[model samples]
Target chain A: MLDHLGEKLIARVSIGDFVVRFDLITIIMSWIVIAILVGLAFYLRRGLRQNIEEKPNRIQAVLDALIDVLQEQLLSNFISTSLARRMFPFISTLFLFVLVSNWLSVIPYLQSPTQNLNVTASLALLVFFTSHLLALRRKGGRRFLKGFIEPYPFMLPINLVSELAKPVSHGFRLFGNIFGGTLLITVVSAMIPLVLPVGLTIFFGLFIGLIQAFVFAVLAVAYINLAVES
Target chain B: MDLTLELGKVIRSINWTFIFTLLNFALLVYLMKRILFKPALAYIDRRREQIASRMEAARKSEATATALVAQREEELKATHEQARRTIDDATARAERIVSAATGDAKKEAERILAAARRRIAQERTQMEADLRRAYAEIAVLGAARVLDREIRIEDHQRLLDTLIDEIDEQALMVKR
Candidate 1:
């Protein structure tokens, strides 16, 4: 456990025994990740459709491959193409944001935003809300709520608890891995101070980062699929 | 339970970070949808449509070319047939013309042969008449020698004239 690495408080306000502490590190890191993603987006937009030739240029090919892979995955998993199209941007951005945040910790003093419970919880909450919203839109409010009581009336409470636990598990899984991994790497590097720990950090930081990001997106998609099932 | 408290001590509790992270992620999603995903996906779709239409156009042109080739071949066949017919007709007409001329030439040769035969027959009759007259003159000269006088010669000539007239009459009857 890294008590010292706890998010630094940027400001605090207290009124009549109620207190609010703003975690500056997590907030700034989240903004940095957002900035990085948005900058990449702009760069991609600038270079988009630059070549109309039959053979795609380097940038076009990379973007095409990325979209193709994501779309193909969605097509395979989703019930319909329209549903996949509707959910594509959210899932893709989720992956890119988490992936970048997780990897950004490789630089000193730049902790992964996803390592913080606050950020992961927000993302999970987004998935949770979006899933229910879309289900409601598709099935109407009455039927959407009735889904938790299906299969057997006796299973209602268990289904409700399961639905509630989804976001918690989704958030904690990513948060725990990134936070534990970064802490372990930092401790090992401080103790050993050698090439082995450095290489290990790179491996855990980048490779695990990628895996965790993919997991988060896939889980989101699965949750959405589960929520919208008729 | 003690471990839980220690974990809580290490893990940073939620704060304004949640709100800021949410806002940042939302902004990022909107920006990505606008700048990156939409345009990129649109370009890909447009490229796909373009390729499909180009393929369709190419197929149509190819079909048209094939049809034109078939039509040209049909026209060529007709022209060849027409030319062959014209040649056949011209050959038949030439043959007819040659045969007609040959028939007329044969008739003209027969006419010339008949006219030559008739002229030869008339010439022979004239030569025969002349020979008969010469023979009568010779007979009158022999009679004068026998009588040893000019007085009986005139009478002999008159008899010869009557005999020659009778012979000419007989030759005319034979000819008829």
Candidate 2:
């Protein structure tokens, strides 16, 4: 119903007061996006060839171009092509998941999972852990910890705050944009409930969805580069 | 207004969804690495190597063809030179045979001419000798007939003997 608009309308499993709670709607939306990406991956996998044709099918060409751009982006940021290849899967998965989740709002009854703080926080946390862990692995714990004291030891707290701020900003950025857009569309639809709101929803939700996905992947790669640099 | 406030609360909430989303993203990355990303990069690398090997094979074949052409050309040149030498040797042999045959013919002709001249000289000398003997016999017969008139047999015989001896002397002088 229109009454339930802008609300994540699904079941919840709550434990003790202020303890752990599970948002079933977020879980379902995430699963749907994951299923789509998996299906697409399988299709692309079936079509892959060692000797790519000069004139490939439409699907092949598009997928190849997507792979090329992603690799180029990674290679540009990272020091080595091997490192780029190693991080490609995680970055691509993050991009596709966010993009799909943000755009799912085009359906009248569906809410984008990225509109939820929990979902965005989880994604940002993954990037956070991955960057630090990889840095620690490559530079060793001593060197990685020592990076905070560089230029001057007085900058240590500032560097630590900045490092901690990465995930918070990364998560909030996507969540705010998507959630704000959804709220605006919900208000418009509540007023008009007609053609104008539909167009506005598509424009803000779909187009901005694509931009947010790209920005998130770019930030993730930049963070990885910062971490990996010795 | 109350519904909008509740929706806003739901949007802001952080719960077990975080854990689920992280698990989902991690699973997706794993599956994609196995099914798509790794294989695609491998395919591209394989394509590069294949193109390089093909170019190398083409270059090798081209070099082999060039070498074969050069070898054939050398063989052809040698064959032409050998043929020319054979023709020159045959020509020299023909010339020598012709010259030797001409010399043998000339010597045979000279020997035949010399044998004919000797035979002609011998026949002429024999004919002259025969004619001189016939003439002497006729002269002796005529002298004997003239002295046959009146004389006894012994005187007539002595005169005949003296005429014959004079004729023999004159013949000897002519022969000398």
Task: List DockQ for all candidates.
Answer: 0.21, 0.23
lDDT of 2 by residue, B78-126 (tens): 9999999999999989888888888888888878877888877776576
Worst 10 residues of 1 chain A by lDDT: A1-10
Q: After aligning candidate 1 to the native by TM-score, how far in Å is the CA of B132 from where it should be?
A: 43
* Positional deviation of residue B82's Cα in model 2 after best superposition, in angstroms: 15
In model 2, how large is the Cα lDDT of residue A36?
Answer: 82
The model with the greatest DockQ is: 2
Give each model's whole-structure lDDT: 0.81, 0.79
Tens-digit lDDT string for candidate 2 (A1-230): 45766556444443444444567777888888888888988888766753364556666666788788877664467667777768877888788789889889888777788988888989898898999999999999899989989878999999989999999999999999998898888788788888989788888789999999889988998888887884
Give the runs in model 2 whose Cα sits over 4 Å from its true position: A1-10, A14-20, A49-59, B1-8, B59-176
Question: What's the TM-score of each model vs. the native?
Answer: 0.69, 0.66
CAPRI class assigned to model 2: acceptable
lDDT of 1 by residue, A96-158 (tens): 899999999988778888888888999999999999999999999899878878888899999
Which segments of candidate 1 are over 4 A away from where they belong?
A: A1-19, A49-57, A74-76, B1-8, B70-176
TM-score for candidate 2, please give it: 0.66
